[model samples]
Target: MRPLQAKIIADLHVQPVIDPESEIRRSVDFLKHYLQHNPQYRSYVIAISGGQDSTLAGKLAKIAITELNAHHTLNYQLIAVRQPYGEQIDAVDATAALDFIQPDQTVTTNIKSSTDAMTLALRDSGLIVNDLSRGSIKPKMRMIAQYAVAREYDGIVIGTDHAAEAFAGFFTKYGDGGTDINPLWRLNKRQGRDMLRTLEAPKTLYEKIPTADLEDDHPQLPDEMALGVSYDYIDDYLEGKNVPNKASEKIEQLYLTSAHKRHEPVTIYDTWFY
Candidate 1:
């Protein structure tokens, strides 16, 4: 692998050691500590989409706040927000995830009305957005909903981004990617599954194919097929495991092309931007 790519893996801390139990405790502790320090925040909020990343995160946040409530004077809650765009196509999966988390409270913000309004306004103004661009709007709308809840409750927004997604830059920038905390940043897809197993989350949550569920025309397309590199391949690459030459080259190229997503929006001070 190229040195730059190797450096990216190292920086993400995707090691071969798989310690789900320890990682869970560490993440829970991390959340508790952050909330304790920032006493102004009364809770941790996460948008659970019935995916492994969000499921694990919601579980951790619940554990953290539950522990804090029991032991500390201050009361905190883990608010699990379900931001469905119209009727979420995978409503069953999302329901199962919410049941498993059993968060202190749950909030559902149907983004369909908001998303449609934006699209309708755009068309009225003699402009239109393609499917891919329209899909990005959902995540941003979801984030807006999450922040609204967080602000209402004096809480923090927790993101589900992990090493594999971060390296692939598969997230919508300033959308689902915008958050105050991420407990799974060091983990990859496989590692996330291991954590879910440790948490005893519903097996189906991890077993089902992972999809961004973004593009309307292609509905429910697997992320690997969309990205042109399997999660196993991405996970292997992140974990420093050797893979086919073509896979490595393609993964490296993906890292290069998506570099912009990995960083903050460029401004005049960004020397590379001009």
Candidate 2:
């Protein structure tokens, strides 16, 4: 009851049909406008994971910085951060994304050492930490690494959260979900790929299956399989297309269960009655 599912599509500003080129221009223009208003910002820091969301975010950020430099003679920078736990299974795709983004700066910070140290400290304190719990830490660590880079550069951390993911509350709270601004907040996953194709993005990066891969035991698992529902269905629902009752129910259930992720931390003054 916290979030009326009926109002979600409108709340997220999801347009069922969109012109990729127009959306791309709009997002880029929004980024430029944001920087113009906030003159103190220096760079746009993005985590390039070779996935559709990050790849698109990075591409748009690079374009923003590049255009600012070309037109306004600004010294803006685009910092692309690569945070892999140990060895990324799809390093090739990540490389390809970086090749496409060609960010002004690329920072590779392997979070393995820090991830392991936290695990050890917890275990030493006589607490039992499961693999799934440890796996969840990777995203938080990656976020930490990104923020560290942003803090050092006085940059704004760009987030990849879009309507579909935000509607389902699919991101880890304060982890992959934490960011300064969301340029892709109104687009869905399919719309994101459409923009990518319009931008002539590498076919491999957009075509590659998206995975959180938080389960160390099961590496490179597709997001649809892990979520128990397909992106097509989520997109359909977000687009206001009629979907099966079962799929709709599952989507709503996911949204309800993960509702806390969508809000700030609860406080004593919070009102829960609905």
Candidate 3:
């Protein structure tokens, strides 16, 4: 792994630099670069799950929209989408998300059919025992639905993958991890939340435990439970706070174990040279 990615994965939780203005500039630069490079993605489709991460990403997109226009008025669209899995947690998130970004601009699409297809495919492959335990199926289904929406609206997919999640590879590669642009890639969880607060995001989103809303009974299971620790613990350890012995140990283990996920695939590129 690159030293910076390793250092962040191991210890990046710290007090924020507290420059809201700087954050805005950073976000603007990121979005401008992405949109400029990917001109086909003039419109943006954000997978807003109403958690702090996505909420903050949505806020940043709004800021980027204006900032982009200020530099030169351009005709572009920002779509805040809620691809619900029909879970109660997701339903609530979808409802709350509309208030934050407004549904007229945000499309709430239920992806139960896609989720069902994934379960059936996994079951046939013997990778899944039953319908309810289809963990990997959900994110993939959600991605398909979001991308369909993005294509329908001629937009590019946007996501909120912060440094911590990226370090841990907490997201399903090419699923929720797939995006044309990510505004929060460099920011840690706390920094993402702080940016949302700067944009005055809804209190519900800010306070809610982060989850991907895969199952109603296991709304929190899809993400938080899988991580084996909350972002708070992860962030605190990264920031160099004194964590409980168990949490400290877990943090160290996670950083070590997930280090491979942060790097390029090991390859025989040197075979020809050798």
Q: Which one wins on TM-score?
A: 1
Q: Could you say which candidate leads in lDDT?
A: 1
Better of 1 and 3 by TM-score: 1
Q: Each candidate: what lDDT? A: 0.88, 0.87, 0.68
For lDDT, candidate 2 versus 3, the one ahead is: 2
Clashing pairs in 3: 13-238, 13-239, 14-239
- For model 3, residues 133-155, the per-residue Cα lDDT tens digits are 65656777778778988888778
> Candidate order by TM-score, highest to lowest?
1, 2, 3
RMSD of 2: 2.1
Ranking by lDDT: 1, 2, 3
Of 1 and 2, which scores higher on TM-score? Answer: 1
Question: Model 1 off-target regions past 4 Å?
Answer: 268-274
lDDT of 2 by residue, 1-274 (tens): 1144457777789998999999999999988889888988889999988899999989998898889989786699999999888998898889999999999999999999998998899999998878878877888898999999999998999999998788778888888999988899889889999999999999998988899877788888898887788899889888888888788888888876776777888888877523
**C-alpha RMSD by candidate, in order:** 1.5, 2.1, 4.1
TM-score of each: 0.96, 0.95, 0.81
> Taking the tens digit of each residue's C-alpha lDDT, what string does model 1 give over 1-274?
6576688788788877779899999999999999989988999999989988899999998999989999988778889998887777888999999999999899989898998888888888888687987899889999899999999999999999999888878899989999999999889999899999988888999999999898889889998898898888888888888888888888888887888887877887887433
